[model samples]
Target: MTQQTSGEMRIEKDSLGEIAVPAGHLWGAQTQRSIECFPIGTARFVWRRPVIRAFGILKKSAAIANGELGQLPADKVAMIVKAAQSVIDGDVDEEFPLVVFQTGSGTQSNMNANEVIANLAIRNAGGKLGSKTPINPNDDVNRGQSSNDTFPTAMHIAIVEEISRDLFPAVTQLRDTFERKGRQFDDVVMVGRTHLQDATPVTLQQVFSGWVAQLDEALAAITATLPALYALAIGGTAVGTGINAHPRFGDVTAAKIAAETGHAFISAPNKFAALSAHDAVANTSGAIRTLAGALMKIANDVRWYACGPRAGFNEITIPENEPGSSIMPGKINPTQCEALTMVAVQVFGNDAAVAFAGSQGNFQLNVFKPVMLHNVLESTMLISDACRAFDTFCAKGIEPNRAKIETNLKNSLMLVTALNPHIGYEKSAKIALLAHKEGSSLKEAALNLGFVTEQEFDAWVIPADMTHPLPE
Candidate 1:
């Protein structure tokens, strides 16, 4: 007797012959074969929620297009639409049990979605599971579609959606918070460091404004990648010829997607290039990597500025979210900055993976779609979450240490830089060195050296005037 004889599993046939699938499952033999064959559980569907939802959206749009084009029966189209809706709404997310490691073309994941939608449609039609009566997973649910086109199409969908729905908002939040803090700390001034050495007096406004500018440029870079993402390869079945697919399939599907998403999605002008190379995906990752670079600098600046309550720069103070040390009492650290910087490092690693995977694949079809999209989506989601957390817990709560700022500003020997244009560079350097050597103030050193007397020193070394240029 077969496992089906026990009533716990059901026997179904595919190209590989009979396979036992759990009777309770909405998937058929194909999905069961994938489950048994590729047991890679790391990059599972659970973590790839965006890709899975994109699959549902793709299927629903395809079914509607197929029905409208007189490709499938109306009843079957209705059944597929309803079943795919469950996938889109996440009502039947458990049915899709595949990993990104299965088939680099993502054929198995496509099959998994096909089978789940098929069985669900079949059941809804009052037919037995795996019947293939009401809907055939390949012939009906995946009509006019190929893993070659669908996987990348879904990749674009998931990426664009995630960027719009999550990444963009999170980044904007951080940028807005930094801008607000910049204005709030506009009046505060402190010693600026260059090469980790004191350079001159800088306003908190200048420091925070620099961070805001980085964020703004990053936002623009990420936004610039969207137009490429909007172009998709839906109609290019198998080898970009649209052999079995209707000629209007790609255009219609993209239109439907655009209607459903309100994004300007379009059919790729060259389906061959879309399937053969992942230039768009790689470019998008490159943009995100650039954003990671900016974020790393900003986060490092925050932590360094808020370095110590006693020994370090201590020009700013961040919110104490939790006890930073297990052994020390009342210890708080810049945990958010640490988390954000770590996220930046991870994004850097993910971008490398994406760039590498996107570069692979032969003439007709790219076999590295799954891994590339996985890394891209992972990076986007991580950046989104990290930005939100960092902004809420850290950036919004940054407060300038007025006493520390004053002390550091007063003690900075670099204020003598203002004397350069007035007394020339050599005299200013002499005063700075003498001040540092004797632990004396710039005023006292200049007076002892007789560079310009008390009145000249006071007029030339004005801290506020040093930040802005004076008429030569």
Candidate 2:
């Protein structure tokens, strides 16, 4: 059932027969049908610019490949390429208004791209949008592709491009910021905690460096999956067979995409696995999940360190971006940490969705293409945005409250562990307990207990030496 609209409507036809589409829009019959059938999540498709653009890239590459193989006329190919370029440049992002929930295989969105591009090419060639005269959506634009192959192909393209072009840079920038902070805080010794209790001493540098290392490992894990994402399943038109597609269509299209995008994309050697299962997307998302876990740890630690000026740890200070409370006039909070940690949680949830959807490959086709890829892309962009925001507003502005750090370090009973080498673990434990019980300094506790003289206490309980190895 088409929604009643007050506008000039054009009649368009597909295999399902005629449907009325708005005259001002570029999409045709199939897209119009999808709009009616799945009247859901109208605002949901707006963020899918990357996926739509990936379709444009795939469509353009297909036309080029078809033209090169003498499968499509040069004039038609030219019009399709120009029209597809408009999609790739985001000029026609508004035309692709199909939500992620429309079709599990993203068939509707594939047709949506086909119709929009086909009509654009038709209009470019001085023909009616729905006539399919100078260009046909199925025959010209989607000449050698199917929703089965092209949908996953576009998923890979979007995933690879978004990770490489957006996520990596944002993560790298934040990692570099933490690394620089590590250097700046290298000399600042601080108390370390395990199980939310003081355990030993570590420089603030070590904490920041640990975050850098986690990011490095996560980045490598994500990078390892890109080669798999670069593998395109284009020639497997419907099932795993080439069928109506040209034999070299996948290879030529992958090569064209690689050349255009500056990524080393190739045709998947096993199109069956490529189209049947989205394990590449799942694997990449797993890596992103690890990064999310790291972000959770980093953000939580930052917030804990910046807990309070008087009551909590108060060892570090983050940026004060805004008023932190509704009623409190002078209170500030770790808002960036909260935002980043929330994004990390969201990525974790998205990972679960991606994993579940990726596992739903029934035989030769995974009908869960849109859900799986949608989650992966959403996680990627979320982490990218979160990392950049956290870096700019919080991590980059982080500064050790040196006086507070020294006070905390001096007050930590865990520093008694440093005296273990000289007096033994049992005696060190006694001294720590006594200091805690009596609210006395380690030196006072040791002297009162006759565990060590002032000179011995001073030598053994040096906080600087406790940060790393030292001889007794």
lDDT of 2 by residue, 257-287 (tens): 9988899999999999988898999999999
Candidate 1 displacement at residue 449 in angstroms: 0.7
List candidate 1 segments past 4 Å from native. 1-7
lDDT of 1 by residue, 1-472 (tens): 0122345887777887888888987878877777767766566745567887899999999999998898998998899999998988998877777767878888888888899999999888899888888799999999999999999999999999999999999999999998998898888878889998887888999998999899899989989999999999999989999989989989998998888888899999999988989999999999999999999999999999899888898989999999999999987898998999999999999999999888887989889888888888888999999999999999999999999999989899999988888889999999999999999999999999999889888777777776767767
**Model 1 — TM-score against the truth?**
0.97
Per-residue error at 159 for model 1, in Å? 0.3
- Per TM-score, the best of the predicted structures is 2
TM-score of each: 0.97, 0.97
Instruction: Give the Å shift of residue 213 in candidate 2.
Output: 0.7
